[model samples]
Target: MKSKVKPLPAEQKEEIATSEPLPAYASEEGIDPELLETARVRLELLYGEVAADWPGFIARPGQYQMMQAALLTFLSAKAPEDADRSGRQLAQLEAGTGTGKTVAYCLAAIVASEILKKPVVVSTATVALQEQLFQKDLPRLAKIIPDLRFDILKGRARYVCQSRLEGVINDVAQDMLPGDMFQDAFIDTRRQQEVIPRDRGQAMRWFKSTEKKLNNGSWDGDVDSLAQTPDPQDWRQVQANAHACNGGRCEFFKSCAFFKARRQAAGATLQVANHALILATLQNESTLIDAGNTLFVFDEAHHLPSIAAEQFSYRARIGTSSKLLTSLRTVALRHGKTLPASTRPDPVAFAQLITGCTDKLSVLERFWIDAGLVSAEKDVHRFTQGEIPQDLIPECEELANLLGSVNRTVERIAEALMEQDESLSVSERDEQTRAGVELGVYVSRLGTLEKLMRSWATHDKIPWAKWLEWVEDAGGTNIDAWLCASPMTAAQVLSKNLWKTVSAAVCTSATLTACGSFDFFDRMSGMNRFPERRSLVVDSPFDYATQGELRIAPMKHSPKNSEFSGELCLKLPGLLLAHEHGQLVLFTSRKQMQACHAALPAALEKQVLMQGVLSRVELLKEHSRRVKQGERSIIFGLQSFGEGIDLPGELCEHVVIDKLPFTPPNSPVEEALSEWLGTQGRDPFLELSVPRTGMKLAQWAGRGVRTVTDRAVITICDTRLISMRYGQALLDGMPPFPVVRPRA
Candidate 1:
């Protein structure tokens, strides 16, 4: 069945092009003009109150106007006859960093919700902004608008499974009984380590007494947060033993934390969630959040396309057999028993199973990769709608069989482990049985993996690519190249499920427009064609001219070879040597990062906080501390350092980008996807790569100016941005800063 919705008609485009204003809805009959004016005054008053109440809540000069425009557009839709018009409304407002976008969006949502009496869903790209909205922004707004209720909606994994926890606790208790004497030595050793170093016996006694505290659902069922709990290993043991909760069917369903959280959200006026969960809900996984009549505010909307892509992508590795074998062997040793010499798990048999599966996976991966790459390399167009190559049919059949065989082998291995348990001592048998259980888990995981592989490889609508990577470990033999596949672009997956189905959506981002155009964001985000949609660009209210300086460095080397790194390494020192040192030196690649760090003088080495050496938070803290102490310091980092960093005043003075960050075309996955696109007759570079790179470079450059008071010199070492045609688009998307070009 075709989608009922079509792209915005030509006439509608002309209407928008002509800059025709939306009709005034306040005069419409049966409409409460006084009430509408009260709502408008409330919104304006709320903004004023926020600015007055918070020290940092300053609205830029044009911000009030943008907010009013958005409100008017929303109000126009609520008018009696306007509701039946069946068209999406769009408002583009560029509220700069300090302009309090959260408050503005909150006001918009509140006003609309009160008028329309429907929930508003706000989606953000990063966790930081999501937290800000929930923790700081929404709470403050809620105090002002007492009638409005809000809830944070995260992914299913965020909440703890009460039934799963109970099952785990029961399993651990049952296993501790006298009959189940066998225990893996590694598990025992791990338990022992939990005891205090000096008083092991006392620690064990204390642990036994406090074990009940672990079962109270305090851990939140989030594995990451569980680490901070006392007796983390024991907590993990409980988690591992926990059964797969079947929602309502499970015994502890009523008290399930996840369910409770969801129930609470049902009555909320505003729902806050990450982009992934939002898409998942739209895909029909759950109906907890209503999409229709909901207004979605996507913060950091730039990363939506990639995030959507990852959600719909799938990958399977072939070297899992080797890892499984090693885990089985460890289980056997820890259980105080060995596999019978005559019938030991045959490595050759495992190798055969892996090779067979890999051969099939390789075919699917290669086909898609070649199709994407060939489409790109050959400059093919209109490749989205096409059939899989006929030659790949045989390979697909082989892959199906290979996946079946692998699944069967994993099951057999698990069964063998279970059978061998009878011959061991009680303790040994228990450990062996647990090993069997572990094998069974792996077997089940493999089954799901196979199903995912089959679904992606054979699915008609989703474009897929297969690629391989080799991994090595210190104590292990060289692993075979692992094969995997994923969708060519997530937009294709989302377009089929969420975007096409949604009645209306307003996709807004600060950086949506390129040179006053929404073309880049629309195309990359897969929302380029929607007949019911409207587009707007609201300029950021930040004073860029006074807040930042953009400098184009005179480059002596091209970005193609090793010489570029050497030249950058030599030249970067000169920029840092004299500066009062809070500098963020961002490189496009690891090679350049390393070269720059290595070439620095010994004195400056102590001052250089390089990426990969420490976590981002750690590096930032150290840099902040040193910069505050009046010591010169330079932070050398890659992509993650580009944005989401807020350092004002002297804590950061210069932001240096070694080159325009672009995706490397040589990646196996990219090459394969490009080839797959090519086979389908698409221009992979323009459709997939270039626009993606353009977005990244823009984000990278955005780090230079954070707050209105923050002033820094942004040095772009890559001359290509100045010389290349596409470079203007990247520059134009950035804040309106004065550019300084060095004389040749």
Candidate 2:
């Protein structure tokens, strides 16, 4: 039998996770005329202030043009009751580096928000950039634009959970529990294991030290505000979790640190947040953010697709049900006795629920193994093109139904716990509060399991891919398989969540366009869904031709060939010494990066900083220190160092790339997407592969010349630039540098 699936409508523009007229698009109605008039006047006055109030602030025509595009696009979308409308917002800008982009977007979004009466939630791809905007740029703008208020906000995990802190402080002097009492509540208990620290000395020291700072009014409870960053293991105990919070019922409610910051954020005219947290807040349905009413400004907007994919992705392990069932048995045995007889969840029912889930999970494991989908030998295997081979659809559908029933049972258990919490006597308030919070956690897990199973069984759902893969446990143990589902494109996620629902939005980035067009991004990001979308490309003011040279080495092998790593490792040391000042060698894979780092000469290794050896901050600090001491320094890094890393002038005189940054040859999602595209008669290599590689190449070269006068040479150790058919297009996409071809 065929699996039940949601069929796409004939005129459906794209496949979305939901069929509801979910959020999207722009409308020309409901704008406040008077507010727009006032904003228009403010823009003129702000233009004069930009040239006057800030030091050395040049009024680049491109910057003004960007602001104009933002204003016009938003004004065109202004409408009353936009949250319920079917309009798609269409404002895309490619403002290259050094175009004063932050200032341009801030002014435009601020003025537009004033007219639309919406908060401008500026989402960035990195915390460093978010901090830079909040600390450096907004304050500069506030000086010139009166009453321009902004707040830098992050996820609750970024703040110290006051209750958890108090608990840790109380136990600081106590000898370690039988198991060290380092219990961590995992949001997804199926896959994530609780970390057990070997020692608590560091954790206690950090807590005591932080408590002293807080008492003396030196620390503000922010993880970033601490003088010394807490060790990640130490921070885990104090990080906020939905499972731990008791809200107003807790004694610490009045002094809650995260909520105070959240309050300030909600009231601010603008909010600076990283993309992940912004998506988290929305997915969590936090009252602090009004997704439909707020105007989202996506900075580093090219990252939207990957970020959204990660946010929307769901995974469930085969053994999770058994583990959770066992945990539930313990909960009922130990804690169920505390509840009032009338309110207690029936032990029989709970057992049945747990047993049913466990049995169903076994059935799933057997089905996958029987269908030859998983192997005891292969460490990792993905479902081909995210499709359930014809013979397996029946088993998948049965598993889907079992999951739905399990989800319902989980909900009932939560409801029982919540009911008990609501009926608690004054003396039982705290105890019930804790139980209610636990219930909240179970409900979340139930939703995750149900959603993934539903998406997997729904064969014809548009743009959602499913995969089954596993990694062998350490010490040659059992392989743990993960059932995963993710949206093929982020555009649909954004369109339904941000674009269609919000009154207006502006997506700005340094490198949004790939292969000299926005079509790749447009298709991937659902920009085509917007009723009336407009895009603007403001080139960088820097003269790339005068500043940098592109040097392509005649390599004996491509990255696809086994000999490439050894050849590059041998050549990099001499090039590192030749550069003298500072250079960054970027690798496409960690295996390659670590191999090259290990193979470097002992003397040269001291001056070479490798990723994973230290924190990014420490590495940058060490690099700067070496450069300041007038010593040669080089950094060996992965794809992360390709973009958003700034090293101008002598700090970075050269950048060497070991290979092109191409998507994996067999990524299930990409393959599934390419297959779908081909069904529509599109070229996968040109449309999907080339543009992604070109953009990464551009970002890699972009690291060398951060300033207008900065001079550097970019060394690419691949000969494919002149040898392969599509190599020239990728090379052309990099900054326009003088080319130097090595003799064969």
The C-alpha TM-scores of every prediction are 0.71, 0.83
lDDT of 2 by residue, 1-744 (tens): 423222223233132213356322212244466765677667756766776667877666567667766765566554436444433356778887778888887887888777667788888998888998898889989987778889988888888776667667875312211111123111233345445554667677778888777657677788887766666667766777665476765666676778888877877999999889877777767776777667778899899888887898887777654466556555543455565677556677666666766776777777667666666665345554567656556655665665566556545544444443555685476544445545445556656776776777666646577777654455755555677788777877876766665566788888888866777778778877764577778757778778888998778888789888898889888878788888999998899888888889999998899988899999999999899899989999999888878998888999999887887546667777787778778888888889999888888888998877789999999888878888888876777888999886
Q: Find the candidate with the highest TM-score and give its number.
A: 2
After superposition, which runs of candidate 1 have C-alpha atoms over 4 Å from their true positions? 1-42, 65-95, 170-243, 317-462, 467-483, 514-516, 666-669, 676-689
Local distance difference test values of all predictions, in order: 0.59, 0.72
TM-score of 1: 0.71
Q: C-alpha displacement of 636 in model 2, angstroms?
A: 3.4
Tell me the lDDT of model 1 at 530.
45
Worst 10 residues of 1 by lDDT: 177-186
Scored against the true structure, residue 199 in model 2 reaches a CA lDDT of 66
Instruction: Give candidate 2 misplaced runs (Cα > 4 Å).
Output: 1-38, 78-88, 164-196, 200-219, 227-238, 329-347, 369-376, 389-427, 461-463, 471-479, 554-580, 589-615, 626-632, 674-681, 740-744
Residue 170 displacement in candidate 1 (angstroms)? 4.1
lDDT of 1 at 648: 73
